[model samples]
Target chain A: MDEEYDAIVLGTGLKECILSGMLSVSGKKVLHIDRNQYYGGDCASITPLEELFKRFGAPSPDETYGRGRDWNVDLIPKFLMANGLLVKLLIHTGVTRYLEFKSVEGSYVYKGGKISKVPVDQKEALASDLMGMFEKRRFRNFLMFVQDVREDDPRTWKDLDPNTTTTQQLYNKFGIDKNTQDFTGHALALYRDDEYLNDPAVQTVRRIKLYSDSLARYGKSPYLYPMYGLGELPQGFARLSAIYGGTYMLDKPVDEIVIENGRAVGIRSGNEVARCKQVYCDPSYVVDRIKKTGRVIRCICLMDHPIPNTRDALSTQIIIPQKQVNRRSDIYVSQVSYTHQVAAKGWFIAMVSTTVETDEPEAEIKPGLDLLGPVKQKFVIVSDYFEPTDNGLESQIFISTSYDATTHFETTCLDVLDIFKRGTGEDFDFSKVKLELGEEEQ
Target chain B: MASVKIPEQKVILCGEFGVGKSSLFRRYAFNTFVASNSRQSTLGLDHINKEYTVNGKVIKLQLWDTGGMERVASITSSYYKFAEAAILVFALDNPASFHVLSQHLLDIVTYAENAKIFLCGNKLDLVGQVPQVTDADMENFCEQCHNLISATFRTSCKSGEGVEQMFAEIARHLVNANRSRMELQTVDKNSFKVTPPEDPTEEPACLC
Candidate 1:
């Protein structure tokens, strides 16, 4: 079969699927390819637990990890509606029945050196309570104001401007309390440090209103997650894309974008040359591959046992310290899963810190697992950072950096061990933890 | 060779950003789903030609999709000129956008005084979160605004809800308008003999 087509989508992510699906539905022949062996990209799911169990000679999930076996893929509906191609694929492939997701409720807040469980329905109330602890009225008012903004509407220029200044300034102007400010501040961090709010005040207000409204409307409240895992959301889209006449090629990395004048004509993947008319890339990969500047680092940690002593089984936390980590802002830690089908009957926590430098050597970096257990279990840490590389095939380098870069590389690991010791009050044996670094496949 | 006389009808789609304007067009014209978002702005205007038979004669209905977020006042102003019928979409979850429905309706009324206007709320699947905008609410809103429009439908492009009803309403209105135009033209004996237009799908740029 000829590899030539009317349009070629560069990445097999959510956005790529939509662009390719729309063009194909419009009668344009389309082809989609991804560098990763799997199609979902960031949303890809693999049985890492099985691999880890094999390495450790551990018992199977039934014999060891026994918690929630059912996985719910939330956000599937929103993703389908957002992309056009997925809808067409569902209809063409008769796979609509496979699309299902369930909503789960959970919440967490960091206090007294550990994450405290909070009621999902009462998160706003808890936020309000937190606001009361701080003596700032303006911050309180800002939270109330955001709560009042309508999200479902098409926000105008007057809605979402972020030039409002420091959290203190916003608090003063709005007459909000300190507790509310901290809660709002922490929420802002979770949404990636007010990136969307960097607009004008009006635009900022609009986005805050939209965010608030979506929360209220969806019953998503302060936070939400995919029912099963994040991966299921994009996986559904990939399935639909293939059901249509569109073709998705995985494990075939595109070597170069065959650009012709100013427009893209085709791409060279390994030895194969796939041709198309238009190409759409996933937004993250766009920076280095398309724009060439921005960088991203993600860390995943798997624990053999659940964190100790939480009343609720499933609550996630977003930690913002009073000070900086490595000269950056506060450290951001999130507990991804307590117990799920993918992990051995034990609990797993995935903490991601963007502050760690990507280029640092693994030997120089210290690795430590700080367990704040009300419960005890085995723990594993996996840190990956991305930086632009020279090789066309490599694209980016993923390295494990020292937890603290200021100290000598060899001593950095010891600093991390000390930080976790002071932070968690748990006597963890670092000798048992294994640290390894390698290239992370895209 | 005998030739059939075809009547002409005009239909227009209007809505706020992200409300499924392009999806509605694809649904009505091609019986297919066209995924669309507010982020990617519509470059220009889209015109689709559709044909149907009425009273033993052929009739043509031209479906036009106007930009949803075009410096609002400008895009709507240009679209109203030739529009004989309009679909004004409002998002139910977004009350702010729904509030702007009056501005769009007024634009159409100012330009095409006699145009048939239909108010539709897209994303009916999200209705559980955002309650359906009842006919009474629309009636009260329209009464206060003094805009006596045509019909309203709660639609979900995802579930294919209210899509057929919307297209049927427009088709029926257009067919009737065509019959009236042909009758009026027939009375003017000096009018030139008209020929039916070719299929619209044949045009490359017509789809976008």
Candidate 2:
């Protein structure tokens, strides 16, 4: 397809989606394209949880009872307030309503190889349990100190900087218990580490304040996943882009950014040339392809069954300790297709980080999957591919050098195979699971 | 040589992330409160233009919002070199971020010592939830931050409170600073029109 426009956005991710939606609403002709065949980049959903549930041998409708509610309630309001026009148009056109997820049955793996159903309020249960541990006076005192250090009315640079105490030192000063300190430290590590936290109290306080605001204003303190699948978000944005007369051409990866006279003029994709005046790529991609600085690695695993410890519940993201694995591996796990209201069998997704040296491009990942043993009898293996794709239902595994790439293929053979391996044992043969490798578009 | 004219006045907003720097500008320029969460860090810089009628003369003010993260300090500093007036934003609820205002002010002073600077404590609506920050309290905080960066205000972008007064104060400061610069230029023995000397030999000035 050939097109011309006032503005052309290269990526259809969240930021670009919002930017393009606003610009189009303001009467600007816009063209948005994604190199991948699908929209939403990392945020796109493919395996509809409802379908996945049925495939997993879920009982008929009469056997299960309960209505699925919108899980993005808190996020919706903030998104609306921040992107008003885009939100309004989305609701008016029924685009936002199309974004849906299924709330699936959850099960918890207990000791002695036992698996039990998880309560619907599992998240609340976890939070209450975690909060209960801090009920002691000493913990309360530490919380108070944290609150005190955070208590500045910062409107300028001078007003905020709480870096005087390292997180480790701050915990020490507050006399927080080891367990609470460990948990909080783990949570902080998800966002940043000690090196980034070495500033004065001002920067520290600012970081805390931002977290507090996100918690209070958006109720995002305990993050939750969409009920249906992770893909709804990007799909919604793609729908919005379409309504705004934006074009999304998948399988057309731009090979090179066409620059003329020191200005970005367009891009060349295979045998086609798409012209544009401006380009907004995810910062990391721009840094890599354009600036050529920094690198990242992403590994994903998908399983047919739910992860043993996490009773088939939706919205759980496990942050593994960096010290627990080898220096080359940093793994995080999440359960996909678990929360959807569908009866699809649950699936597990695990992302492991690996550097170029330790990672293999064509290694059989299934052998690495193992059961958690005493923790839970969940099968855990790494497969190269997911089921139902290749002729023999074999798994096809892939290794990516970027987090964005892994997220982009979260539902494909690579992710599904990884999840299956993590939930099932490495010896579990996927000879029956059809899998295929994702194509590289250019 | 062709003659060039420089805008006699300008104001810049500087602060840590999520401190209502953008909110303050939006409130003053468009009378709107567009609440936004920190998503991606601001790349390089952001420029917003507004025309304010001061002293019966239409004066154009260019407001630049710079990122606060240390990783992007180099990129943000590049935008700071040309600023004439700097509005330093701090959050009342976040004391640690406020404490860093001194170092930020030092950065600005190192680049342009004579630039007019205003310290603003935002999120006044959260004063009760947060520890209360009184006018006297801010005065003392400013004194400790640095004597050179003294003017301060408590504003909230949420309730549209104090936003107007804050901008009015900024406008008043810029007008006064422009007058002082003009008077100094007229009286100085050096050329009244002091052009920024371009020296290829000198290292490029670090903005941050």
Candidate 3:
């Protein structure tokens, strides 16, 4: 309580924890606190089916389902892209040692009326159940071109400029149909809107490469989830921070972030006071410091069976293309069962989430719920997504953006890296992080 | 230290803040106690890994200390999830801290259903020096708390009294509990029956 910390991180959410761990590993004395005692602030895994029900004001679960202890339903469910930044951070920080990971079973996309497993490679594209004979050939050619693409090689560009050419033009080059473009952009490339097709193709091309590369790693889907839930991620980083001598306090009310001359100076909680130069927290911690940007609607549904046509897969992520549903953003569906140790055997927890565009949020997600068939219990929530109005240069209080509606951590990592850049006044050096991992080992 | 890639178990420490939970953690982890004058509260959730030889097998124990934040309802269940053992610490000199042990025990039972529970009256060195709490009171509290857990230990982080023995006892119990649960783990993963529960009557083996 009396120590002067280099930084005071005030939330155990994934982003804050990562920063805390990284700062601690970088030899910065950090004091991480959370009003909530748990590690993950908003991104916690709620267990004991009855606890989730109680949180929703529902009655205790009857004995029709399996044991309550057999569930680890995530409040904010997300899957880690195998080759994603989060994975890289996990490895670079050695946070991966604290946990076990299971590759997601399938990655499917919603088409006209049905769902289809995303064809990852040439063979899968040809053997795909979702595409026609000639369309399959066109998609295969596109995949081949994408695989041959090299960021540094002009010959791989094939008369097309990825930086200037639009993704729509890239699709047109292969004579791909609109339906195929729908899946390719929203599902494989994991874009949320039509905006990507209008812009340069390089980002989209790289995303496709990330997906294929990650798929190449696990040979099933491009995503990997921890055994229990996304909640373990924050805990893993918290462990990393503790190992590096960072201090952690939970349920301790942060009475005030003492600001001196317009910059954060320290924190006061009850009779104890700790001095710090910089403060980092989530949107909720510094509510007045952030601006309301958007809102997200998430529906957590527990079902006795998997989504039909997912090949009886135990864990899967189904993307509903924004164009298919005529929405501003794509709707994400992520399901994990007892196979991944998130739910009981024969029980599945599927969450449907999307950026809220209209007033009728419940009605907006009808297309997603219809695909879920019958749900045993459904809990719905609409949360405001906020972002810091300005970088913490002035206040020294770096506030992380709210958790996005996406079911993957790509955007989440972008925000984290961006925040790290704005806070450190330097880009987070990947090589330096790896080198530090080696040097700090002894 | 890097993980040894052995069987892993998470053990949680719960109790009031400033009740020597962190002191017990330091004692178990570094084999040293924090000076009382310079002691700082655990910030949030802090953990240290220790490898234990349990029943002829080497198991990694993730000793998690809750930073006295167990009072928060939302975060309490998270600490309990997947925990195989729990050590409920209380300051022997403070009656209020010891009084909250029941609620903390409820958290352990509710989230970590089959976890082995141990009760530790910490700061045991201050028993006679501090007139508020006495040995007779400790005896009576143990008589009641022991009924709720496996065993009770009077520990002093300052004197290193009973800390190692408390952890060793918990480790032994956890190893045995893990072995018994192992036979059922595969079956439990495959079958619909509940993994294992302390109270079988409250929840049927399977289904809801």
Which structure among the candidates has the greatest DockQ?
3
**Candidate numbers sorted by lDDT from highest down:** 3, 1, 2
Return the TM-score for each candidate structure: 0.45, 0.41, 0.80
The digit string of per-residue lDDT tens for model 1 on B1-208 reads 3964554466888767667776777677666765554334443224566776556556566776653323222341334544678888887666776778888777777655668888888878777743756557777776776666666788877678888777766777666755566577556322121111234233211000
**TM-score-based ranking, best first?**
3, 1, 2
Model 2 lDDT per residue over A1-442, tens place: 4555555666655545544544444445656666765455544443332332343365432322222211111101011111122333334333343332222222121112222221112243344333454334454554344444524444332322344445555555556655444334433223222343344444443444333322332232323233334444455544444434455555556676666775556667787676765554443334333232223333334444555555444434344322333223223333443334222334344333322223452131221233221221122222221122212112111111122212122223233234223322242242321211111111
lDDT of 1 at B101: 84
Give the Cα error of residue A201 in candidate 2, in Å: 4.7
lDDT of 3 by residue, A352-426 (tens): 999999999999999899988889999998999998986898998898999998778988888888878888887
Error of 3 at A183 (Å): 1.3
**Local distance difference test, each candidate:** 0.46, 0.43, 0.79
- Top candidate on lDDT is 3
The residue ranges of model 3 lying beyond 4 angstroms of the native Cα positions read: A1-5, A8-12, A29-39, A46-72, A121-123, A159-161, A238-276, A285-289, A338-346, A429-442, B1-6, B11-79, B89-100, B119-148, B151-175, B183-208
Better-scoring candidate (lDDT), 2 or 3: 3
Candidates' DockQ values? 0.01, 0.01, 0.07
Docking category of candidate 1: incorrect
The TM-score measured for candidate 3 stands at 0.80
Evaluated against the true chain A, what TM-score does chain A of model 1 have?
A: 0.60
Which tens-of-lDDT digit does each residue in A85-160 have in candidate 1? 2333333322232233222233344444444433233344445334344333444445455544443443521243
